[model samples]
Target chain A: MRFWILLQRDVLVAWRKKSNIYQPLVFQLLIVTMFPLGLGAGAQTLQKIAPAVVWILALISTLITLENIFKDDYEDGSLALYTLSGMSLPVAVIAKAAAHWLTTGLPVIIFAPVIAVLLHLPASAYGILMLSLLIATPIFSLLGTVGSALIMNLKNGGMLLSVLIMPLLAPVLIFGAGAVLETTLGNTPVGHITLLAGCFVLSLTLAPLAAAAAIKVNLE
Target chain B: MNKIVKFYHEMGSPPSFYRITGHWLKPLLILALLLTVYGLIDGLFFAPPDYQQGDSYRIMFVHVPAAWMSMFIYFIIGVSGIIAFVWRMKVAEAVMMASAPIGALFTALTLLTGMLWGKPMWGTYWDWDARMTSELILLFLYIGVMGIYSAYDDDPRKAARLAALVAIIGLINLPIIRYSVEWWTSIHQGASISIMGGNSGIKEWSMLRPLLVMALATKFYYLYSMLHRARSYLLRTEQNKSWVSKQFIEN
Candidate 1:
């Protein structure tokens, strides 16, 4: 009951702001547009690197809005209230990350095909690309929640948060991009997809607890 | 048994930890230095050159040990993190925070020496090989741990606890990262020397001995560095405590 209310409350709050929905999408489009401009719009080169380019862009754009996951709650004392409310903190963390994924990760997944077409990613790899993103981006939100909670109380924590989570995110990038690249080359992407899904499952079970512990430390 | 338990409890106290580690510091440093000098000499000059790669393979004396220490220190940090986070042991917190920079240093040394070794062996200073990529990621994990510790400057306790959580998370992820990188690709040679690999392991006693000695040397060096740093961390964080003040007067 509390989980749904918290999740609904977060979604409602994000919906009210509206920029929260569009900012990351715009940021994703702007950067996805840069690859063609900077890389000379060569279809061959763009297709070759498309999987990596798309995955990396997804990683960074999600990162840009990660702070908003916990920043407002931390500042307005809502996090403390949640802590004191005797509701489970990890449950709240999961709701917050799920809300973050709905607003941020889901848009990127939905909009990824446009980026894919722009990058000349082959029509063959499109489904796998979206599948990988579906698995990968939620892991990003889940892991990002832990990083965000850790530094939520600090000034200039944005860059530190990126540095903190980048190593953890590298495997996600490897498997996610590798899946699409394998598909582009006409190979079975079963292995890459399996590993990517494994990463998501691991983060799903463990990340909320870690994020809750970090939030408790910050509240202290 | 009673004495061991008593000593363990005493070591958890900050002042006792500082004093006990102080007593062992000089000997550990001396042992590390002596073993390092002996290992490098024997490995570089005394050990027969590798049949395939010749003397160039000698870089393993330094590279292999530093790589071992890099991973070993992280294991220690993770264990200390659990102790710190669960028990809130002050000594464990200091040890965990202090191990980060040392771990980072050894990790960097491993990468540097591996690159130098790779240039001759693999014809490239860098490769997206499995072991090397994982080592590079290990370096980043160390940097992240150190970064989180330094970020919360105003509150040492918060910093320690938060960094502890990060270390624990990294430790859990370490195997996943290693597996993913290994699955991605592998060009690095398989482990040449393993204690239990029997026939598949290093057969040449001359080469194996120096490598083992070098490994022992690095362990001593890590202990020396970790204790020295943890003492300073303890003194700084415990400055207001009466024991910390008394140490200055006694010294």
Candidate 2:
């Protein structure tokens, strides 16, 4: 009950501010367009770089907004009264991460297939690409919450969040990009996707707990 | 053992820590410098050059130790971080916070020297060898700890605790990241240039011996620098406290 309420409040907050959803989407689209211009519109070239390019752009998009996950609730004193509201901090962190993934991770996963097609990513790899994104992005959101909770006190948090989370995100990026790269090279992407899912499961269980601890520390 | 433990307990006091570390600093620094000089002279001149790469391979003495220290320091940070978070040990917090830049330095040196080594061997300065990529990410982790520490500078103790948490998190993530990176690199390229290819990464005893000496030298350097940095950190953060004021008067 508390989880739904907090999750709903976050979603509602994001909905009221249309830019929260819209800006990242636009950023994703702009990066997709910029690649061809920068890398010179060679279909073969773009196709070759497409898997990494698209996945990295998705990572950056998530990074750009990750700081806001805990900032607003923290600033508004909601997180301070979290224990008083009879909600466990870890459960609340899970709810917050879910809301963030719904807003940020979903759009990127849904949109990655389209960008993959535009960048001439092999048609055979599309399913694996989307599948990888579907598995990996939630972990990204979860890890971001872990990073966010630790640095929520910072007024300018964006850069610190990247440095903290980017290294942690490395495996996700590798497996996510590798799944597509594997399929492009005519191999099964099962290994890559399996690893991605493993990362997801691990982060799912651990990230919220870590974020909860971090939030408690910062609030106190 | 009891005496050592008691000594540690006494050293945990800020004034004692400052005084003891100050007394040890010169000896530690001199020991590190002497070992480093001997290791360099022996490793560079006395140790036989690689038949394949010749004199250029000597960079490995410095590069490998830096690489080792880069990883080793993270473990120290991780242990210190756990201590800080679980027990709220002020000394552990100081150690964790003070270690970041030194860790970053070693990580950067590992990359810079690896690149220099790579240009001759791999025919390119940067090709994302598994180790190099991992070191680069490790550098980011160090910078992240430092950045978070500075961001919380107004509350120095809290900053250390928070930075310690970040280090612990990064430590947990390091292996997963290393696996993905190594797997990804092998998929894209092959196994990296082995340090001792023919010897299967265990070099001839002649080569191995000085490398060990250099590694020992680096350990001393780390101890020297860590003690110095932790002392300065203690002083700066504890400046308003009476112990620090007394030290100022004596100085």
Candidate 3:
């Protein structure tokens, strides 16, 4: 119940503000639109590079919003309060990651298709692309929490966070982009997507505990 | 259990570690330098060049050892992180943090030599191939640990604790990342996980001898660097303590 309440509170807060939801979607769209102009209006080239361009933009969008995951709570001293409450820090961290996925990851997932269309991603890749993003965005949020918790006291967002988490994000990038590219190349894409799903499951199970520990050290 | 606890207590104290490692620093460096010479001379001159790529394959002596050190040091950092976290071993924390830059150095050397070797062999300086990409990511992981550790300059102990946790998390992910990179590359390029293993690859026993020698040399070098760096880290960390003052006077 406390977990759901915290999740609802985060989602509601993000929803009420609206920009926290829209900014990353807007960022994703802007980058996707730029690829056509930046790389010339050639659809073939656009189609060729679509998987990488789209996946990377999705990752950056996640980074854009990951800044606020714990910074706000940390700044207001609520992070300390959350830990002090009887709810338990790991559960609270899971709730926070869940809300982050809902607000940031969910929008990125929904906006992915439109961005895919804008980037001229192949029609066959569309489904696999959506599926890959659906699995990937939550992982980005979950892992991002660990980095965010570590640097919450420093007062900067994703600058250090990027360097801190880039290596961790590589496998996600490899699978998420690799899945789309596989489908675009007309392969089954089952393997790549399966690995992405596996990482998603793994991160879901372990990331919160790790992030909880990070937050504990930062607050202390 | 008592012996293990005793060993832990010995290393748990920074002054004791500083004293113990300080005594061997010169011998370790001399050993690392001697092995490096033997490996280089034996590999470069004594070993025959490859039948295919000729002399360029010799870069393996440097590249392979650096790569091994890169992965090996990260593993060391992870284990040390766990020890530091579980037992609050001060030396382990210092070792974990100090290992980062040295790991990054080895990773960079691996990448540089990889690029040089790639130019003649793979016909390009870069490919998104799994080994290279994962090696690059390993470099970033090293930087991440160092960056996070340094970010909390106001509180070194807390920084080490948090960085230790990161190292532990990263250790868990390292193998998974390596496997994923190999898998991803195979899917994209149809390349095998490693190109240097077994008989089908770079398998000349003559070449293998030097590679093994260099690998041994790099281990000593890592120990040399880790001991020196950890001593400095301990000194800086314990700078406020009277033991450090006594250490300088005694030295």
Q: Pick the candidate with the highest lDDT.
A: 1
Which residue segments of model 1 deviate by more than 4 Å?
Answer: B186-201
lDDT string for model 1 (B1-251, tens) is: 99999999989999899989999999999999999999999999999987777788888899889999999999999999999999999999999998899999999999999899888877889877777889999998998888999998888999999999999999998998898788777412444222113324468898899999999999999999899999999999999999999999998
- TM-score (0 to 1) of chain B, per candidate? 0.94, 0.94, 0.93
Return the interface RMSD of the candidates, in order shown, one decimal each: 0.7, 0.9, 0.8
Clashes of 2: 0
Report the C-alpha lDDT of model 2 over A161-189, residue by residue, as the tens digit.
Answer: 98889988989988989998889999988
lDDT of 1 at A97: 93
Per model, the share of native interface contacts recovered reads 0.80, 0.84, 0.86
Ordering by lDDT: 1, 2, 3
Clashing pairs in 1: none
Better of 1 and 2 by DockQ: 2
Question: Per-residue CA lDDT of candidate 1, range A25-87, in tens?
Answer: 788889888878898888999999998888888888899888768888989888777778788
TM-score for all models, in order of appearance: 0.95, 0.96, 0.95
lDDT of each: 0.89, 0.87, 0.87
- Local distance difference test, candidate 3: 0.87
